[model samples]
Target: MNKPIVAIVGRPNVGKSTLFNALAGQMISIVKDTPGVTRDRIYADIDWLNHQFTLIDTGGIEPDSSDIILSQMREQAQIAIDTADVIIFMTDVKQGLIDADAKVADMLRRSRKPVILVVNKVDNYNKMMADVFEFYNLGIGEPIAISAAQRSGLGDMLDKVTEHFASLKLEAEDDDRPRIAIVGKPNVGKSSIINKLTGESRVIVSNIAGTTRDAIDTDVKWNGREYVFIDTAGLRRKSKVKEEIEKYSIIRTVTAVERADVVVIVIDAIEGVTEQDAKIAGIAHENGKGVIIAVNKWDAIEKNDKTVYEYSNKVRQILSFMPYAEIMFISALTGQRLYKLFDMIDFVIENHSMRVETGILNEIMAEAVAMQQPPSDKGKRLKLFYITQVAVKPPTFVIFVNDKELMHFSYTRYIENKIREAFGFKGTPLRFIIRERKEK
Candidate 1:
């Protein structure tokens, strides 16, 4: 489902990051006593009650500041404000209403968007409650007293924020196409491949648009089908991430992977697959996403007839865990075999959502058990009553056994292999859910 976006905006040192951390339930944004500590915009998914929305924490918007960094900060916050469905205008209760607060209030009032006035640093309820009323003179809305540091009165504030979502129309989700994410280490041609796919002359789908401020996601149509391409920041080595914004970008990359239905792991052809490449591919596989390894810059490599075979063997050896993933060699610069890559993504998506009937599943289970009886545990042979597929998008199956503890890992692997052989669920992971059968 497409969730509404909410932005937390305010001047420097008003505890915007603190309230953001409190609501997010983790330290996503770095909080400090120093002013203007947060320079980049940080995003997180927030689930309040039955409503869900994307929460963005932006750097302090110093509209009047002439400093280069502060001016850039203002621009970043402006982007958040323009993209957000609702805006949280936070203030400091101790500081009272200052000129800068009034200035920002005027700016928000003119924008005519839903603005929730939040009073932060209200450490004491009774002492700050009286002071919070002073913010009403700004003519925006009722000031909500909250102690982001103490983490109090957040439920009431969230109630007020979600109420506005009912009035705002969120972006519609596209269920027709597979959301493909392209991820790799830095300097891996992730961006180049996307640009090539959605070239100016290409049949780009302009119907569905992304609400995110970053234009990393592009929608394109190919072969009478739509595909949403999510371009992620190249995940850098931990030691190389020297700036705070780079750390936040890493979080964005994870969010992209979680939202994608299929993940295209791009690798450097000349460099081959490295440990970092394995790690990136592992994340997609572990998350149960249909994975495809695309070796970019293939044209740069001097290759013979056996060169492709040799390189593919090395890739499989490194990513042995993701045996289901298909490998394709392409050159982003030359657009070599680009059409084949798109077709492979569609093929994987079809298998990712593949489901087998219960009767067929049980048939496969019986044959597998007859061929090789489940391993004996202390002379108590394991008994699998039946098997049924419980879900898709990973093709999860449940095996009803006499005792769950008796289902050894090797036996489960054998069952999974049998199911894969019976039905071609290629380019997707198979998950076995073991359960103890209850006798009537």
Candidate 2:
């Protein structure tokens, strides 16, 4: 089911971006004290309880006849309000509800969408309670007091927001198919690889940078299995992206990576791995997405097996931490080794989404512990009682042990390697959690 959209709108410098950052659980938007720092509609997935919604932090809405920049900002806010299922009409509690906020409130009231009045900058509950209540006169609804900077009262506000979108289901029921995002720097043949896998030119193959502005979604059926592929815009460094469109494109790419179950980082074989390539790979690894690096334009490289080996070694050196990630040498233009790329992707996706049974996990853990017991801390040996797969889509496991702190990083790595070796989870990263065995 599609997640409902929630838009945050307020007058200039009313902590819209701050509140957005708090709710998004990340600093996606650039939050400055200056108004209009958020010129574009920034989106992030907000997880509240079991409910998920798309939260959009739009530029402050100014009067219709304001300056060009403010007018553009107002236009963007209106666009967000129009697209939103729930509108958060944010006002400044410290500023005591200005005239411009009233004007914006009038517009939101006319919008007739579910509106939740948010009184921001309420650092003191007792002092700001009256100020928050004054917003009720705007005739939208009861105001929820919050301090966006301190991230206080956001829980109650989010609870109300999710209430509006209660009809929409948040999570996917079917867990078989994995969502893969094809991401890379500009001109690295991302579109070409996506086209080859899907067997259609769904995305326009262009040599130009920033050709794909928005993230495009497409489904591919390979080996009698379905996979969702998201083709995102070529992400450039923030300093290099001068245009507003390019900046937003990078934001969209990051959001795509966060949502994806796996990410295919494409690199140009001729150019070799650049710093930007490493940055993209780092984002995938940080997000715990199953990553597969594809070296495109392999046919154009002027060398034989030795060249491929040397280049692959260099790439591996850069991404040494992600040992589970598989690297493939493919020519997106000539389709050389392109078929193997999809096969590898499927293998990684399957491994990332695998769920190990508790009995099997405990058996593997027992064997692993017997092989090399965890090191002692002050003669207190770590006793691992059991292990269970807590989640899939990266295959997170929790190991119940006697001394969680005594399980050193090296010992934990040993258990992880043992599980991988026993389970054969190739081309996928695994997360291990060591917890103390509680006495009943």
Q: What is the C-alpha lDDT of each candidate?
A: 0.75, 0.74
lDDT of 2 by residue, 1-440 (tens): 44577877776677887888787755343333212223343666677888876777664233345354344445444544545678888788878966666666777778777888989899899976877888888888889998999998998998888887865443466654667888887778998888888888888766767665446778888788788888875423222333443434444555567668789998998888776666567657755788899999989888965987788789888777677888898998899998887688778878988998999888888888888867887877888888888987779999888877888878888988988888878778888888897655
10 residues in a row with least lDDT, candidate 1: 203-212
Task: List ranges where model 2 is wrong by over 4 Å.
Answer: 1-13, 16-117, 123-143, 149-152, 169-177, 233-250, 357-363, 438-440
Estimate the TM-score of every prediction.
0.67, 0.74
Off by over 4 Å in 1: 3-47, 52-123, 133-141, 147-151, 164-175, 183-187, 198-219, 230-245, 251-260, 271-288, 304-323, 366-386, 398-418, 430-437
lDDT per residue (tens digit) for residues 1-440 in model 1? 44677878777778887787788775333323212223243555678899987777765233335353344444444554555678898889888887767867777788888999999998888877889999998999899998898988888899999999888754355465678988876567777788788885232222121112242668978888888988774322122223433333334454566668899998999999986677567557655889999999999999899999999999988888777888999998899998798889988998999989999999899999999988877888789998888888888999899888889887998998898898878889888889997754
lDDT against true structure, model 2: 0.74
Which of the numbered candidates is closest to the native, going by highest TM-score?
2
TM-score (C-alpha, index-matched) for candidate 1: 0.67
